[model samples]
Structures are given as structure tokens and as C-alpha cells.
Target: MGILTDTTHLHITTWVVAVILFLVAAFMQRDSKGRKIVHMVLRLFYVLIIITGLALFIEWSSSDPMTYGIKFLLGLLTIGMMEMVLIRSKKQKPVTMFWALFVLFLLATMFIGFMLPVGLDFF
Candidate 1:
């Protein structure tokens, strides 16, 4: 539990794993073997991501409320985009827009996340 003792590590590890799972699920063929299982695991990571992310925000938001709030909102939107992509994909509809939005949110979130701990005031 040494590394887990650091909230940053916990948050980052789960975040990376969640994204990896997402990429895997996204590329897998429709109704392919293990698709549901991969998605279920990905969902669990989403929960962990929310929990750990909230904890980080609770601690860090005091320092920069604006950035934290934006990050939190972006996180929510990222998840929403992920769900939208999945739903649209399942319905055999176009998810190109949703996927683009998801990537943008993910990049923004990570950029701000790395900057936050260092007290960077780019915003």
C-alpha cells in the first residue's frame, strides 16, 4: 500500500488503466468475445476515477477553485462523452463527434491535472 498511500499515484494509476480499457473497448469488434467483460471492468475504473478524483479535488480545490472546478466539470463531460459514444455505437449510429469530444476532454483534463500539483497558474 506504499504507493497507494499517495493519492496522486492512486488517481493516476486508475486513470491510465481506465483510459487503456476504454481504448480497448472502443477498438474491439461489436459483440465480440469479452467485450462486455472489458466494459464492466472499465465501468469499475470509472467509479474509482470519480472517487479518487473527488478526493483530490477536495484537497486541492482550496488552492485554486477555478481550475479544480473546471477540471471536475471536464471529467464529468468526459464520462458523458464516453457513454454517448458507447450508446451511439451500439445503436449503429455515428459516434465520430462524440469520440472527438471525448479525446479533447481527456487531453484537457490530463494537462490541467499535471499542472495543478505544481501550483501552476496558467489559467
Candidate 2:
């Protein structure tokens, strides 16, 4: 588990890249092939984020399962909201609610992650 000895950094990096990709895809023309390619890449990053997040959760759950569990769920919801917004937008549907939820969940997940024991000591 040497490579996964520190999944925190890997998880953060994946999510950050995912967010950037999401933004890029969101702003692109819905009918463009480039947007579709970026969306696919973003989905790959989503898998990476989930894997690294689960690794960290498994390693840190014993200390405070409740908080870690909450963060885990929030992270998943954030990802779901991101996907929903993109899909809806591509379908020419209104996604104002999904966009708001995506931002809210992302912020909450990040705040909790930074406050966790294994996370950065920013707070």
C-alpha cells in the first residue's frame, strides 16, 4: 500500500482536475465533439476521485467514521450534481438547480475534507 500511503494528495488532484474539466465542458458548445471528449475525460477523473476517496476513507474511518462518512456522501453527491448539470445542459434542459447544488456540495465537501484529521491543517 506504499503508493496509497498518501491518497489525500491524489484524491485532491483528481477532484481539482475533474472540476476544471467540468467547467470546460460546461462552457463549450453542447453540440461540439470537443465537449463530448472533455466530458469523457471528466468521467475518467470521476472514477479516479472515487477510488482515491475510498482509499482515504478506509484508512481514516476508524478515527471518526461519522464525519468521514458524511464527507464521502457529500463528495458523491457533488459528483452526481456535476454530471446532472452537464447532461441536462447538453439536452437543452434548464439546470439551474443542479448548478446551485453542485457548487454547494463542492464547497461543503472541500471544507469538510480540509477539516478532517488526515487533511490539511488550514483551519
Candidate 3:
């Protein structure tokens, strides 16, 4: 497989891209054309994040199933929060809670990813 298809590479890259797109979508003006485009792109990023995350989880779950399990659930929660924020923003509703949860889950996911024995020097 080429470098792009590598699970670890894809996982990290997608996470970063997803976060960036999430922020853009979150901050865009309500009901604006730009916001719509950004939100659509953000949805694609979410899909990439899930796919790459699950690939990594399956690879690492054997040795540390407990950690991976928690991370997996957190990942899902993070994605859900992302979607919630978008919906709330589109409706012009307050997204404070959803934003908080999104940040929390995103950070937790990164913390776990960083601590894993991936042997990468990203830090």
C-alpha cells in the first residue's frame, strides 16, 4: 500500500483535518453559504476520522483492549458532539454545551492517541 493508505498516517492526518474543518464550520455565520459548504466538508472529515480511527482501534485493541474501548466510545461521542454543534449552530441555538463536550472528547482522544505505544515522535 502507498503511504496515504497507511492506517496510522491516515488516522493522524484525518484527526487534524477534521478538527480544522470542525472549527471552521462551528464559527461560520449562521445560514451563510460558506457555512453550508464548510459543514459539508466537515461531514466528510468526520467520516474519514471514523474510518481511520476504527482501523487503528482494530490494530491496537488486542494488547490493550480496555484503553482502546474507552477511546473508541469517546471517539463516537466526539463525533456526535461535532454533529450536534453543527445542527445547533444551523438553528441559531446555543451550542455552548455541545462545544464543551466536543472539545473535551477531542482532547481526550488526542491524549489517548499520544500516550499509545505508536512509536511516533509527533510530540
Candidate 4:
């Protein structure tokens, strides 16, 4: 496979992992230690995904600012929502809104990835 194809595969995998983490983190029972562990592992996976994504971006030297900008914004929103969820999870506060928006952001990321023209590079 070509380098671009390989990078695309990795990017898709990262997003898939992120989606799984979001679902697990959002819906798992709060009192379960196993759930907590799972959430932690998912968080770690997300961090890895983000780091790998950055490395890929740098390696590719993407030049399409619009796609990159959208992705960065979505990433920030996702992280912010996750932090909110974590903070409220301990307090048993309703976090449905956060989760809902997080999911939407994930979808938006996927949409941007799919809709953007190939070879439209970003820094």
C-alpha cells in the first residue's frame, strides 16, 4: 500500500478507537471499578491516537488549512466535553448534554475527514 493509504487507515482506526472510548465513558455505570479502568484505558488510547495523528499530520505536511482547522476545533471540543464529563461524573451530575455534543463532534470529525478533497494539504 502507498504511504497515503496507510496513513488514512491509521487515521480511521484512531477515530474508531475514539468513538468506542466515548461510548464506554459516557454510558458505563459510575460505581463499577472495571468501568473506571476501562475508561482510563480508553482515555490513554485517545491520547495515543491524538499523538499519532499529530505525527501523521507533520509527516504529511498537510496544507489545507480549512480541514485542519475544523479538525483542531473538533478535537478541542471533544477534549473539553470529556473533561466536563469527568468532573461531573464524580458528582453524579447530569452529563447527557456533554456526551451528546461529544458524539456530535466525533461525527463531525468523521464527516470532515470524508468530505474534504484528497491532496488538499494543511500545515
Q: Tens digit of lDDT per residue, candidate 1, span 1-123?
A: 333334577887888898888888888876776767888898998899888888878776888999989988998889888878876786789999999999999989878777786333455
How much lDDT does each candidate structure score?
Answer: 0.81, 0.93, 0.81, 0.67
Candidates 1 and 4 compared: the better one by TM-score is 1
Where does candidate 2 clash, by residue pair?
none
Off by over 4 Å in 4: 1-6, 117-123
Per-candidate alpha-carbon RMSD to the true structure: 3.0, 0.9, 2.3, 4.4
Q: Which consecutive 10 residues in model 4 have the weakest lDDT in total? A: 114-123
Report the poorest 10 consecutive residues by lDDT, candidate 2: 1-10
What ranking emerges by lDDT with the best candidate at the front?
Answer: 2, 1, 3, 4
lDDT of 3 by residue, 1-76 (tens): 3343344777788878878888888887888899889888888888888877777777667888888888879988
The model with the greater TM-score, 1 or 2, is 2
How does candidate 1 score on lDDT?
0.81
Model 4, span 1-78: residue lDDT tens: 245344566666765776677667667777788767877877776686677666655554366766766776786677
Clashes per candidate, residues 3 or more apart or on different chains: 0, 0, 0, 6
Residue 112 in candidate 4, Cα distance off native in Å: 1.0
Error of 2 at 70 (Å): 0.3
